[model samples]
Target: MVSTVFYVFIFLLALLSYIFIKRNNREPHKRLKLPPGSMGWPYIGETLKLYSQDPNSFFAAKQKRYGEIFKTHILGCKCIMLASPEAAKFVLVTQAHLFKPTYPKSKERLIGPSALFFHQGDYHIRLRKLVQGSLSLVAIRNLVSDIQAIAVSASDSWVSGQIISTFHEMKRYSFEVGILAIFGHLEERYREELKKNYSIVDRGYNSFPTNIPGTPYKKALLARKRLSKILSEIISERKEKRLLEKDLLGCLLNSKDEKGQVLTDEQLADNIIGVLFAAQDTTASVMTWIVKYLHDHPKLLEAVKAEQKEIGKFNDLNNLPLSWTQTRKMPVSYKVVLESLRMASIISFTFREAVDDVEYKGYLIPKGWKVMPLFRNIHHNPEFFTDPQKFDPSRFEVPPKPNTFMPFGSGVHACPGNELAKLEILTMVHHLVTKFRWEVVGSESGIQYGPFPVPQEGLPARFWRESSS
Candidate 1:
């Protein structure tokens, strides 16, 4: 009886302390005219709960309970979640000047002080101009022979009836494309070395910023130094030799701003690595899903194959690569890609912090609050997309409602390499489906969706080479 009384007394004291702390924190922010939403616990916030749930369901539940626009504390910041395309445009496109890109403290620290994705204002515009032009449709056409060679070689490696992971193969293929297009052709041994270190740096994006021994973050920083050293040596060699090849890296090296200021070696390396990092996994994820989607829907698979065959008839099918004009001929392929992008929702949202006190539909979004425009919500909304959950590429026969399809994001902060990503996916998918007929070799429930969609089993499948048949 005495021990039970002691436990009750302890519980009473804890409950009183929680009430007092809650009341204290609430008193100060009363004058801020904040949006109608909970701020959650101080400092720790709602990160624990948010991280534990599937991202799609978490956002859906919140939107259902709190309405289209609501506020919550997540990732240690007080954030406003905008769930409509109109709101997305207002925040991201219309009144974009009122906000700036804001990421978590851990993410910022991992990306470092010089990561180009964090750039804002006039500097972003100028730096973007330097890199964006080369990834355009016109520029991409110039490098088709190289991209085609790599794609064909990579696709040819899967022997008939062998159980292989399409997801794994695509990851390696995307990395190879990045290496050949960005750095020119390197020896297979050197390319493997760069790939090994890059995988290390990639882990840091989702890791804590802690620098203790044995931490992923620490290993990533060390790997970054090695990668930078490799890039710097290549730059030095090109400078000494006066090399000018028709490649992205070559274009970057020769580029200068209007002021005639060239990028420092570090800036060049950061951006080159940035492009590689950006292009690889996201495109690979899309490619993996396309394979899964096509296999699951046989009619769509045959349609894509038929489209490629029709285009192939006009070209030197054996030696000639698909030109920009032939690529444009695949309208069915374009629809399929858009559907995959929407269904997969590769990037979930774009987060920007309010620089000043901002108002949206009379709701006060105070200074320093994170403004998140949710791409997934808009893309999956039934109103904008009928039967949003269904995988039907025919919907793309008509364009999506404006601001609704943001697979690569939109506006000033849009991904400059989006055109390149689309071109790569189209090229890779075109080659794979035309050359092979495949079937799933494992359970389809293996898709792990969160942070990004990944096939847990690497999407194992059996390959049947069309030529062999």
Candidate 2:
């Protein structure tokens, strides 16, 4: 027994030595002279610090301690955090070819490779063109009535004085709009399934990688399977019908590349799911923030109401013919939407991997190292926006220097749905302001950030008919 115990201790020591040697041998960035940051310890690196309760604060602190560019390790990989507009433009716009979207192994497992968000080079360009053209001004203008009608219907369900979660409501609203815009008057049951599939995909993002029973990843996989099944059925149905509706799905179905080849059913389904996932979360979060901001600042609400009143009655929304010229004329409403997005940036950090060795500001960026463009830092920079913490939309009236404000990101991979997102936000805000007057319920109400930051406590607001009624 003594000999066995001694041998066990020896084995333990040997393992520790091996691990120490391996860690010591890990490539060092001595040649790069990159900016300073806390690397923490092995495996976890700065992940714990980087993902602390207040990631924004943590990032800000790091920037304060170590200028604009900083280096850190996360999940055992080297990463560089770019905060300043100069670095942002250099990395995102000027040197875009060297940087590629980077996702964790777990995320890839959930979202799949066929999704447009993950595609690169020519494929991504083609997919983006097809999707963007389908959601063009003409296409979205046609769906405006549908969107307005849905908004009215959704508002009808809200009860005065009853506590309701605006975040969830916005999710449902965006989901419905996306469905109508993408699928166009599909069966009610089919639409419900689309909502379910999105929820599954979202939940999957928060799950651990384990695919065992009861795991979130496992459930997400099941959800993906269900979503794929429905998509397959829809594709098969479309094929059989051969009637083109000219909606997004229809466009994809009818579109062919230069080689006369069309996107396969699976490819189409993945793209659809990708768009839904992207559109739903960001839009819902933005809407929720808009509501929260309006509730928090009653003066802003009044301004919005005045703008709506200038346009006419709430009921006239569907009937009132609106053109791109008219839409851009709502400057206050536009600024409010822009400010909300800037304040409650739904996506804080966009990750990219170095596709090849590159140099920026005399620092070596080795191939495969992860790069993070910390937009939150840029947005809140005092140098760019005076009193950045204050919720003021007017600041945007005189736009900040380019690349300083990228709520939807910058460069080629910038969100294609930016225009549609803006239109939807303005429409929703216009309707809400004209329809009802709401005030924040309690002092406890506040915004929260995580994956997609929104109202911490749902921004429960007590609603009453406006005095103008």
Candidate 3:
């Protein structure tokens, strides 16, 4: 009986030894087998070069050398650039469940940690649905008149002979619309104060992510703190009054998640700032580009004018606001905006992280590695859009392939404010084209696209109303 017990103990010891040996002998996570590319220097690998003076040229050169999906370290993460429609769809749609939206440390810090822009998974879906419910068609339709008034008011401020920076003008116009639509009307001083603060925040997104004294990032944080205090005051006043209104702030105050929990005061503040920044910066950038492009191509300008004239025929262009249906029906306007979005590529690249070690198109994307959808490269790919660099709005007359035109990205993580952005763009064009005739004063200094697309000189131009001229 003692011998039997000893033999059993010996057998258990042997099994344990074998298990430990196997673990020690196993390979290290298959060595990743990442796509072909250099990792550059230890840290800050290719980050400066990627965001250099001519980032677009750098990307184009890299793409020419290394096919679509190639690995490189950028923005403190080892990432792969997905520059083809197939890759975009694969990462953003077909196998989307395996990827989650991500942003660089800089973006997250500037946009706020709790902003809806950073939410992922079920929370993201819930947030998007709640916001979408508030930004309903009827709500947007109601905003058209106000948007038009702001656009026209700003456009009128451009004296006939004065050489104004179209970029600056568009920025003021878009920001004002956002302010009014979100915070309600206020004195000009308050409007300018908000604009100044938001501008600081916007500039920080493009600046290097440093928080030392006098750094843009530091100033931005300070501005954010001030802005937060301002918003908190507004929220306090609104809560005390218990006054229900229809603007963005009001809708958000009443917003509730799928679980019926209302957004916290801080969450609501972050989103309000985020929405305003997104609306003002991107919409203004695109509209400014459209003006430059249209001035460059007169034939297309005339085509757009014709479309606007037709739309105006249904209602007095001077007094009556454009109906929602009329704005969507403007094909020429739609094509023009699409072409601008493609050419300018306001959002050059967006971030996604692999949920696991993913094998896509025979290449391994290791878990936690970022997959950057190269929107600008795909928009300029000749295979997808013929003569991709040329500003031909007609290319959009017939829609491109599924994932070919991704100005707003694709799949579940696409920009939730895309439709609202479109509405804002259309409104700007409708009002500007109908009200004024403008000409470019200086040749467009090519786009500067580090964080967002904007002309180097801000597209200085001369504009005058038809009646005034």
Candidate 4:
């Protein structure tokens, strides 16, 4: 009887211990608060509400109500929106390892999963260094004359009195510059083929991804395949020629793992396409905004024109192209570019996903949740810049507080080609201001999001070439 009683006691003790341990582990999450905000309706979340309004306004409203870090659901995913620079720094710089870069499977399929931005750790580090070296100041400096020529040709093609879409024209110019940086000098046929297919991919990039036979996304998928084949041909030709030059392709071809393994063709194509994709729209958007901003502010236009015209006159007298050094010295134009990037904030936010449950500032960021750093909100925050709505370039005269002005982004994943992008912008502005004058055709001042903010109708404008003095 005493033995039976002892056995019952041990059984009860084990059961109680199991329950206690389980409760401690499971109930902590229940006790922990998620950042405060509405998840909206089940499954759908606030996606419609977000898409229905200006994305900036949607984010601003949330930040105002819930403070810098808030929780919300959009596009069927739980998301944490970080608006403060500290929070952004934590996620992007310090604690980046806890969050991995994330993108939709469909988009990943389109860009090819091998793109460096989709990776982390060693692969990302290796690929980023190569890209940075190719786009470094030293390398791009040598391409100044070539870039100037492309810029001049682009602006020259805009016939006087012809109403052209400035954004469209800028896309062409940026694409050419991207190609120049990638291939040094591609043959005309190859360039044309790449451009033609790339336009299809660009058009479909933001389209609702679907596998329907006639859908834009489907068409993009087809074009992507063709691009792969074309790239293979290019790679074969390069290999046959044994080209050992130092362009991006050359760098990739020559790069090896610790084991001395080179990147596969798919990896090569993906990164090449990735660089082109990154280079095109964002730069074009900013350039378009610069044109509009210059037009809207006549004094600013004259100021930029004067700065550029002086350089032009000097170059013309010397019978020289716009040198890399000349491109760097335009303080006035440079400020205007900075101001434009701030105003547009082309890359409004970036997406990262939590790899595990994480606590930030006493709040739980549950595993698998999306974390987006709202760059536009941080940029436009009145705390950082006085009169955030104003288009004054002088605001940039004093540098913005640290971590508050991330035009290209911050940390490990920041844009490798930012210098090239800036160079292209400065070179284009020089050509635009010195060689031609333009008028915005429509006075309608409104913003359009072609997955990036552009002026409505791509900033319709009429261009007129100035007679040589």
Candidate 5:
């Protein structure tokens, strides 16, 4: 009878334990709430609302209503938008491991799956180090003269009185600079081939991803395949020559994993294309905005011009190229670059996917939800800048509060080509202010978003080379 009583006691205890465990598991779900915002229509879920108006307005409206951390569904994914510096830091830096970088499958296909930004952990670290090393201040400083020469050549093309799309021209110039960084100096035929095919890819980058024949995306896919063939031939020749150069291509060719495995040729090509894509549009957009901003703010433009022309006069007297040292010391132009990056905010936000259920300030970000750190919103916030909408470079006389200025982004996945980009911008600015004069050809003062915010119709303008007196 005692044994039977003990058996009954054990069974009852086990039953109670199971119930207790289940209730505790359910309790957190009961208590944790999703951030507050509308999910919008069923599967479509606010996608139309986002694309229907200025994206900035959409995000700003959301922030105004729901505060910094809020929930919304767009592009068919539920997302948590973080606009505050602390929130951005939490997602991008301190707690980055919990959020993996995410991109659409279509984009990955075009840019290549192995490109640096699409990765995490060791693979990302390895690629980033290689890219950063190749574009480091040490490496790029050597290319100052080469970049200046390219800037001069490009500026020579803009002297025609005919209206020119500043952004389009800047894209060409930045692409040339990108080519220089990647391959040192490429053959003209190869350069032309790349320019031809890359133009197709650029046109289709934001197009609807469909396999329908004759569509822009289809042409882009074909061009991408052709680009691979061209890259393969280039790689074969480099191997035949047994060269040990230090350009980005060389760095990729010579990289080895801990296991002594080299990156595949396909991987090499993806990153090459990725670097070109990275270097071109955003830099072009920012440079174009600088042109517009300088035109719009006469006093700031005159100040920048004065600074650049002084450097020009010195270079002319010494018969010396614009040295890297000179580029570093352009306080006025540098401030303008900083202000343009802030006001334009070309890379408005970046996307990361939650790897697990994560909590931020009592809000639950469920696994697989998209998390966006809205850099543009933070940039335009009045708390951070006195007159957020004004094109005032003087505001940059003092350094911005930490985490508030992330024009190049922050954390591990931040852009590796940023230094090269700034160099190109500064070089271009030096050439423009000292050698050329331009006038906006039309009265249109609106902005257009061809993925990045650019002035209307690429800021059509007429250029005239400043005559030597």
Candidate 6:
């Protein structure tokens, strides 16, 4: 019996070794000639290098060494990182359907199969349409008063001559605004619970899916349960009331398919959670960056303030008595917001998975492989914007090439909330500029990059009332 067991163990080891060798030596598909890249060894091919200390710098070095397109493996999947304008446009616009968001396992683990981000093809399109009407220009105009009220309340809490963390404040403001805009209520307790749940989900982004006692995934799972319960309760309440308010949740509940079919309760919950997640997290990060930029550069702050002053006071912000013609005239505020987005992008890279083999610039991209268009590369490309790192609003005055500056992405999946996000940001910053004077308390480099780069430490700033009263 001992001899037989030994022989079996030896046979299994040999088979595993043979399989590894075969996988490594497999030839590239005849029609799929991938871009040039160094794939080091089997199992752990270039993954460690790709995820090194500074991935952005690493990718930059690789781009310098090996032109626009390069192949690498990440999270056990083969991927090509596309950098050039033509490649980005092709992936984002021309071939968008071929490439869906590439994080199914993560989405499933964090928010379950029902989440809109996990859906593809017709399901995704349908859900997107249902929510799009809420973020339309008219819808935003309707919500302007709510947004301004939240901003003013947040600002009122700030004490002059005290060092405050703008990041936290921005998170609270944006969270409150998102809740009011979507659900039409300012439930503080629910907002607090949702924030805690989202933090767990955020931390689980790059973690292994072992739901063991101390794992991030475990915490994320618990958080998901809490979030889903809250969302379900809200949906139930809305259904019970059957009120016909024009908020996002109302719009979603009322929407129907061409055949008059409505979304399942599960689908509705998932989508509402998706919208809240998207609107809150990224907007908070963007707001933090905008405040940091203004603090770091006083001159820019003055310009933004002057523009806001021209628009009128806090009371006049949501007053539609102010015309669209008048709003269009605030060029400086518009330019400042554009430059802030360009400099401190909220999303570093957008992921997509190829559905089929495709050719680009003499390289064959295989199906099921992930494609990442690094927006940072496009935003900071020297060829498109001279001295790209320099914070210059004038660059946006005359827009660059088609795909040069895509902070909101491009094509159908481009953030539908872009206009509302811009409005929230501009309104908040305008309030800050008019209400208080703030200065950066530390080195600009102190700010760090997470999934989206935000102040590593809460952006601490010392505020004093502006004297120009």
Q: After superposition, how far is residue 460 of candidate 6 from its true place, in Å?
A: 2.2
- The regions of model 4 sitting more than 4 angstroms off are 1-30
Candidate 2: residue pairs that collide: none
- Tens-digit per-residue lDDT, 171-222, candidate 5: 9999999999999999999999999998998898889999999999989999
Off by over 4 Å in 6: 1-32, 160-162, 186-189, 203-208, 313-328
Candidate 2 lDDT, 65-179, residue by residue in tens: 9988888897668999999998888777888888998777777666666888786789998998888888888778767667777888877767556867777788788888888
lDDT of each: 0.81, 0.80, 0.81, 0.93, 0.93, 0.77
List RMSD in Å for every model shown. 9.7, 8.9, 4.0, 1.8, 2.3, 8.3
Q: All candidates' TM-scores?
A: 0.88, 0.89, 0.88, 0.96, 0.96, 0.87
**TM-score of model number 2:** 0.89
> What tens digits encode model 1's per-residue C-alpha lDDT throughout 246-306?
6677887898877998878888887788778778888888998998899899999899988
Please give, for residues 1-469, the per-residue lDDT of candidate 3 as tens digits. 9999999999999999998777666634454477888788899898888776588787788788888989888778999888899999998898988988787777776667777768777767766675665566766777777777887788877866989988889888888877876767755766677778888888877787787989998999888887887777778888898978877788888777668988787787788887887777778889999988888888988899889977776677456678787887998889899999999998888888998878877778888999988999999999998998799888977878888889887887677677778888899898888778888876666776635778877888898776622
Q: At residue 7, what lDDT does model 3 achieve? A: 98
* Model 6 lDDT tens row, 313-419: 64355664333344456688788788888887678778888888777888988888889998888787799989988988877889878888898888767887887
TM-score result, candidate 3: 0.88
Error of 6 at 420 (Å): 1.1
Ranking by lDDT: 4, 5, 3, 1, 2, 6
